[model samples]
Target: MTTVLFVHGTGVRNPGYEETFKLIEKAVHLERPDVKVERCLWGDKLGTKLNAQGASIPLYDSTLALDEEEEDYSIVLWQQLYNNPLYELQVLSLKPGDETAGNPFGEKPGDELNSRVERLNPSTELQAKLDVAGIAEVFEPARDTVIQSEAYHQALQNASEELGEYRDAIARAIVAQAMLDCEQQEKHPPILTDAELRDEVVKLLSLALGEAELGIGDWVVKPLSQLAQPIGTFYLKRRRGIITQSVSPTPCDILLYQGRGDRIRDFIRAKIEQAEPPVVLLAHSLGGIACVDLLVQQALPPVELLITAGSQAPFFYEINALYSLEYGEPLPDYFPSWLNIYDLRDFLSYIGANVFPNKVQDVLVDSKQPFPRSHGAYWTNKAVWKAIIPRLP
Candidate 1:
């Protein structure tokens, strides 16, 4: 039986697996029950554990010592895991410590005689002069007393808090690492070269920057047109320049775009290799840009079909003219059988204009309603699905 593996993108939790699995199962069973369905849980636990270990010393010395970027990334990654539907049922709860003042060490006085001797014992010299070393030893104060003391209690609380913080930090780190690893896998796939991955990154970054520029007007612009245009223009131009320079084709010593793009490309390539073949890649928003990078820059294997809905493709063209400008080398061709879905009103989808190169075709779905917030609903829209299902094998 053919197998289907679904890989979720960022800002989701492990627990979200069940709901997603059910959705896929329902869709597949109705379509093709003979095909087997399996979920490969890329848990953040291990990654979290590793992250915790690495940050343990830093956390111990000063929580402030933690890298701000790393910490922020870790928190975002963990929150995603927490929000995931797969492991929602598997959430772990902390247990309250036993309230009883019972001895945790299981140590007690030796006997009645020993207890009496301890009570009657005088100075150390008198005990030694009496040649009662053995008895004195039996009557010695219990070391376990400190274990049950208030000082020890406070110490334990501090330790527990520290341990919990470390665990949380590590879990977030693991999720981040897993995300990075997943991206690399997608880029390299099972059979591809680093050079291809590098190239794809440049292309995808160009596309992403364009999308960001187009969408900025909706979020960044204020009602007053006078103030909005200048601010928006400045932001757009500056970011556009950054994106263009990053992808410049030169033999310069350090290629910033190559590094960033390579990281994302390599991650995607790795994800592709570990999973079954003939997969359908469903990417949304910025994820779509990454997918494009994987396909165009990394030279990934063609899947059953590529579906991108409410994608940022249109914005890439609006934000800058660089993508449209004729360059020395020809633009790369990608996803010949690709399906690009967009909502006419969704600003993020960049749907209302001609953005893609002449080679690529865009399929506009009515979205059953006007554009805008309906962008994300494109995947589930009956009309959108109607267009996409026919294309899928």
Candidate 2:
């Protein structure tokens, strides 16, 4: 007998997941009546804990917070002008599931912009070169040790703390430049991404702080970069009002899992162990991301075919949301085979192949629906079952 374990995704509270699972379960039963269907139930537990606290993930797009800039600071005016909450608003205006505008490689607009920003910021440029060139092949020998006036690393840390203020000033400067460039070209000024904003800001800081000898990509120049990731997860959920202050037992735990081996690992592990061999692990959205993290860990239960739909694993990886991958390493070769399904109409569902490369296969289907509907529509789509039936043991 094969066990099919269902894992759920983000922003789902009291989702009545069993009904959704039953849809997939019914399909599986047609193929193998004897197969056992089980749910990992991680969301239920996590949600219960969160709702008890009357908590919701804090919204993070504090472009307005930039307003508190020191007035005497020369760039204060720019900070007010460039702080962009509009990026999220603009993104929301896009029709759900509409095929994005032309980019043959199927990259999102942000990915394309990163390439342009790379020219301005060598940190990203070097990282890109290393990603394709293969990090193992790169070599740069250290110079002979020289005495230092203080702990070199700690000194770098101090410089980094001061760079935070400079980064804010720099972001405003970039926005101003973007505005000017568009005016000259007779086009509307576009929203600046954190990187494009930072790249431009770094250039400005380089000129402004020339006497301080700060350069882009310095260890001291890192812009609390890790903390920047969760805002995407939080902003997406907060905008959806997935959970409320008068919260029910249902919790959206992706925000919680952001910094943390992932929050659901232990629960999933226990359930998988009792399941029949050659198990089929099916997951949706953030649940799928959790499954990937669980499977990729050392010495975990084996899954014959891993199924995912409407997941953010690829998107999360791209945004550096996966802490395990912050350093840009590939999933282990032992990583389970993944058949990831995404509907373009579901803004949250992103492609995984380019991110996971050889380990994941991408399947596209038309949901032809809007956001909440497109994300949840997978269970009813026969195309999803067709992909699953062949993979079942």
Candidate 3:
């Protein structure tokens, strides 16, 4: 009889392992009843722990740090701004503005905007401002993008005779949109490293519209600054407990195994040795990493096929971080036939065929779920079962 040795991923202790293992065992027996199934449950035996109850970490459970009133909100706000150039604009538009005084004697609210809107061409002289700002490459495309965008049109309709304020807001939005465009093309420069250069780009663009960078600062950031303080304090006070409860122990297992993996590899080897001939090693996540390292370091002739699902072994090897093998090193001749299964939605899953060439066979299966969820959805996926059952030794 053939032996199928199942090695589970990180963070899987006894009760959880039993539930997941039974699912696999049932799936396998339904198809290949003649094959004997075994398990190498290493997580419970060798997983890392906070034996000192996290005493080594500074301020592990302390909340006194929240008493400090000086909270800087700019860093987090700027990070959000970098990802979404129109964040401030979106927030401002959502907010309710104070009622404007009746202007019976004045032109309608948006009339002045209609007159000047025709002249608000970002592609013309603004291109020169972008060129001097060191992102000339994205100017035309960015300009076209903003002019055609629904947000830009909406902003134009909302502007009153407050031409200066609206123009300044529009100019900054254009510049920020240009930065986002450059990033999407994977050509973002290192301008943020020199804050002066980044500021100059926005300043120069605002000056083109005969205004300054006061609109976003006075109208948008000031209000957000007030709101961020209380929110930041609430999170700060409960951060330690929140992290303790939310953060998974899986990362600890990965780190411990990467740093010192002798026990995990040895445990897998012992399982392989005791299994019947034509043994197939089926592993997932970090277990897959340990199995790959073991197979590469030493030959186990009884192990005829190796299967990995949602594994980072290939990623580690490509980064030259794998414990047993370096990047560019060929797999040993003694290594068995390898099958790697991946789900595109599972960000943890990676392709090995390109890196290992002919040695590894890569297959894709969709779990129809978003990542983190997709990572664990493979076992329930029918395609995953079909792929493995046919390849079993």
Candidate 4:
């Protein structure tokens, strides 16, 4: 029997990533039922800022950096994650049939949510004690508690106060990091549409604003933008877990301990050692990086195979931060059999062919969605299944 360990990258996992693991297992089992699929949940090991018991944080933020230059302007890399607030406050505030204000798609200046509240009809048993109005009365205080909380006020105030500076930091981070000087950025910088600017302003005002840094040439700048973008998002998603979500001095064990993630590699190594041999390690996103780091940098026993999908190792290589390799060094001659696959739509996923040369087999899949959506699409996609089955023990 072959054991395949599925590793995850950045983002909050819904249902603690059980859905993800199951999806991958089903995808793989469709062809090979005897093979076993397991998940290495490292998202919580770092910790989270989300608190499900209190209220859902109305948190949504993404950052952009210049990627390539086009005709009149450069294209900025959009780093987006969908971590919505638990409940819809606006919907709860409105009557059951009220129409919301604006059309997001239409070319209108004003916009408001056009959704109406959907109240459930009371059951006969429940109606014995309370009428519809009585039920509404019972729930009204919960809504008030959410809106009137001191924490909510802090969140609102913090976002509003830092809005302007975060916007400046967004532009500055991109300009400084693009390897382009200030004058060059002014001349051919990426032109953002009104909607883009409006959205970025909120992101700049987001909880993640200060943690991301813009790279200025060879120098990296922090305190301007949060450089720990991935880790911050992961923390947000894992906020529902009790042990992981507690307010702490260290919000992210992964990013704060140095972006190389040695601690995670140690965990991965331990998992690998415990798994039955003839184990085929399957890693996604950051998990891929940790697995590679373990084998190359640490003295871990090699598994049967190393398969990675939607990984960011190629980008890490450019920074000379991949712990195993030296400056300009190709993949090590002793590196295990590795199969790397990626989706063209997930810009975060990079091609390793040029970097590792012939040492790595790179496969590209067409995930119709763009950007981060494509990043996790590999879990159930048929293309990913085909790639995994052939390499299994």
Q: Estimated TM-score per prediction?
A: 0.38, 0.50, 0.54, 0.50
Candidate 1 residue 240 Cα shift, in angstroms, is: 26
Q: Which tens-of-lDDT digit does each residue in 1-393 have in candidate 4?
A: 677877666533322266567667876788889887776776666423344553643333432333222211111222221221211222122212112322434422111101100122334543332231122233233323433534323322222221333223332322222212311233221111112332332233221323323222111122113323343344234434432433221224335334637667776777777777667788877677777777777444437788998887777777886767765986655577889999765666887888887767898876443333456667545676777788787
Better-scoring candidate (lDDT), 1 or 4: 4
Which scores greater on lDDT, model 1 or model 3?
A: 3
For each of the candidates, the C-alpha root-mean-square deviation to the true structure, in angstroms, is 22.7, 21.6, 17.0, 16.7
Superposing every Cα of model 3 onto the true structure, what RMSD results?
A: 17.0
Candidate 1 has its poorest 10 consecutive residues by lDDT at: 212-221
Question: lDDT of each model, Cα atoms only?
Answer: 0.37, 0.52, 0.69, 0.48
Q: Give the lDDT of residue 45 in candidate 1.
A: 19
Q: Kindly list the per-residue Cα lDDT of model 2 for residues 272-340, writing each as its tens digit.
A: 887877688898877787787777675454587789998887887888876556526888776778899
Question: For residues 22-85, what per-residue lDDT tens digits would candidate 3 score against the true structure?
Answer: 6678779999998888988987888776777777555555332222123244433443455556
Mind giving the per-residue lDDT tens digits that candidate 1 earns over 182-217? 333332121011112222222332222122111111
Question: Could you tell me the C-alpha RMSD of candidate 1 in Å?
Answer: 22.7
